[model samples]
Target: MSFYDVLARGDDALDESPRRSRTWNFFSHITCNTVVGLSKIVLNTLYNVEVKGLENLDQAMVAARKENRGILTLMNHMSTCDDPFIWACLPWRYFKDLDDIRWGMAASNVCFTSKVTSRFFSMGKILSCERFGRGPFQPALDACVRILSPDNTLDSEHIFHGLGPSTDLAASMAKNLKEERNPLSPEYKPPVLRKKTSLLHVFPEGFVCQLRPPFNNSMRFFRWGTARMILEPTVAPTIVPIFSDGFEKIKPEKVEESAFDFFTFYNRGGKVTVNIGKPLDSAIIDGFRDEWRKLCLKYTSLQDSNRMSDELKFGEEAKRLRSKVSGYLREQVSKLRLQNGFDKEDSRFSDVNWWVKYTDTKGKSDPSVKFVGLNWACRDYQSNVKIYDEKGNLLQERKDALCGPKAPRKSH
Candidate 1:
């Protein structure tokens, strides 16, 4: 059977469960997903999202299904919420039009450690890679090859959305300046580039940051692998450059505490905007990492310089952007909820029992929860990956499978 078949089985596992329990899984589908759906609807009712550059999306699978031309869709990283937004904004036919449309995502092995996220969000086979595994990374490498291979089964919907940290961006820049004598930054480096005849989504920024005029010159440059991966003798693929604007609303504030700064905007259901930039000029990107590097670096650096203090200086740039995007994202999300045929809210997870059981450094719970050393959460730390055996220091990665005897069912 194809891998998709197995994913179908996993999806069915939850669906097959006796339909009348007060369990997390039961509540998640029945409640959480429903509420999430409703929230999207509530937001969408207020605005109409405009997708200006989607034609740039090389509909690889669709084209291949028709003329058999594979594509590479490159994008910039922003929120975990990007895909669903794209799904909602694009025509239902675009997704349904393709016989095999999968998403290529880079998710941590730990996020899948839970039955919930493991089984649902990442139902497809996982890449199972560490953040910076410089050595041979077979699992991730294999998964990449398999997903890119047109022969792979369509039973599962594979999406590659690497939520990897962009923090290393600054480090990448630091390394470049220190060694190669150049500067750029973000928290993580993208995986090595590989040349293949399949559709791929590349996020140049490595992660999300928004709303500084030079929005975060701190953009982690797109790893050269993006170029090296495609420039190979393999069938050349289209390289699209995507830029998004609404994420600025949820900007990690402190933009400037001044009444006029970034702190002015918050999710308060404000607008969200995503613009897909036109495809990169292949003549400029093909076999030329330096050219590609220069463009991506300059593209971002130009955005971040005035991102913070600029907003502090300018009064309503963020406000204008937010008003436009918040209205748009909500509309897009609502259309998606409607497509899913869900329009109600589920409040079960709100009880907190279903919330992730978080533990911090020093093995304490609440104390370490405060983001230390950086505005970032400690969740991304190696220490965050709980070590099961104190003496051996085995991480949650090496722990036994979590499918244990059902915990004494909590009677509602």
Candidate 2:
């Protein structure tokens, strides 16, 4: 039978039992495959997307598979569509198992703002996490630890909200951890945990940017959670670096507000370029973490932020290192971007007012851009594809320029 027919069969509780797992498994497999397929076409046709460093990704995947480990993709966030776009470009050769082994951490405020959105994202293996809260007590870190931990200890006990709870607070918190019910009200069944996945994607910047002025000079600094994930012993996920640009060119309606517009998605066109880098050697990342600690301890503020101990006090050094780590990772990403010919000048895109008004000037008062299928887009446009190694050195390149007029111009 068709995929949707099978999917409709499991419309009830997704986690009811092992039978449900198989049902949803079949569903997710079909759905993600469809998404990837459509993404390939839309990305190529509408955006003229290009990719490099497949060899680097392939090598890392090989090593990860050999060791039965996971790869943590560290990326620069430029737009709301960043996560799905990356997944679309990920090499299917490695993820052929289709076991939903990929995961991404999404901002809680954005992803879980409503039940509808929460359900849509949960299917994509996206974990909702709080962006701002007390330091040394991050819920995101706890979530990451659970997903990466092979033994699954973090899942059993919820991480306490704040630093230290008093006698009464401690008892209440302990009880909350032992239950499998909603945190706010005990009567509700806890949402089913997202399926087990290995590869975790994170945009450490904590916020999306359109490369506007002032912030245009450098990629925004990232949080320390990525570094923390790398240092964790549970998965010790290899750090894979990816650089992507051109999403801003679409200039979607209300993009500045960060709301996703499906019309703009279907009608957008621009060249997107991505470069994947080799997994940073674990030894190198570990060594950097060690050096970071020494610097933190030497400075009281840094030490407090490190949360190495409860008695430590916040000091200036911690603040400095926080900025330092952010800059270091941004620089690495910038290097990849530069290698692939992306610079600050090409960081943003805007739609002419006349163009925006022209798309739906007739019957549809509001624009309703239909997603032209991926195959149609690919068949319509010529694409240039390349593969590279860990060093940002090219290993292979291919270009297919079918005979056809270029993608329609989006603006006057």
What lDDT does the true structure give each of the candidates? Answer: 0.34, 0.50
Worst 10 residues of 1 by lDDT: 155-164
Give the lDDT of residue 307 in candidate 2: 28
Predicted candidate 1 versus true structure: per-residue lDDT over 183-301, tens digit per residue: 12243221212222345454422234232332231222233223323322122344444444444343443312333431233465565554554444555443342332232333333
Model 1 steric clash total? 47
RMSD of each: 19.0, 16.0
Q: What TM-score would each prediction reach against the true structure?
A: 0.44, 0.59
Candidate 2, residues 1-412, lDDT tens digits: the string is 0011111111222332222355555655566667677776777667777778878877776776566556677777766677677777666664565543566677655466777877666666666665322232344454454445432322212122122444343344345334422233434332233334366778876656443343342344466556556544234556678888766555321312222245457336667777898787677665655554454334323212212332211335544444455546656777786686645532221222322242224213333322211111122232343333422345654445433443433332
Q: TM-score of model 1 relative to the true fold?
A: 0.44
Task: After superposing candidate 2 on the true structure, give the runs of residues whose Cα lies further than 4 Å from its correct spot.
Answer: 1-20, 99-101, 134-136, 152-197, 213-217, 251-260, 266-269, 289-326, 343-412
True lDDT of residue 83, candidate 2:
64
**What lDDT score goes with residue 9 in model 2?**
19
**Residue 170's lDDT in candidate 2:** 35
In candidate 1, stretches whose alpha carbon ends up further than 4 angstroms from where it belongs are 1-43, 46-48, 58-67, 97-100, 124-129, 133-138, 152-198, 210-218, 224-234, 248-269, 281-412
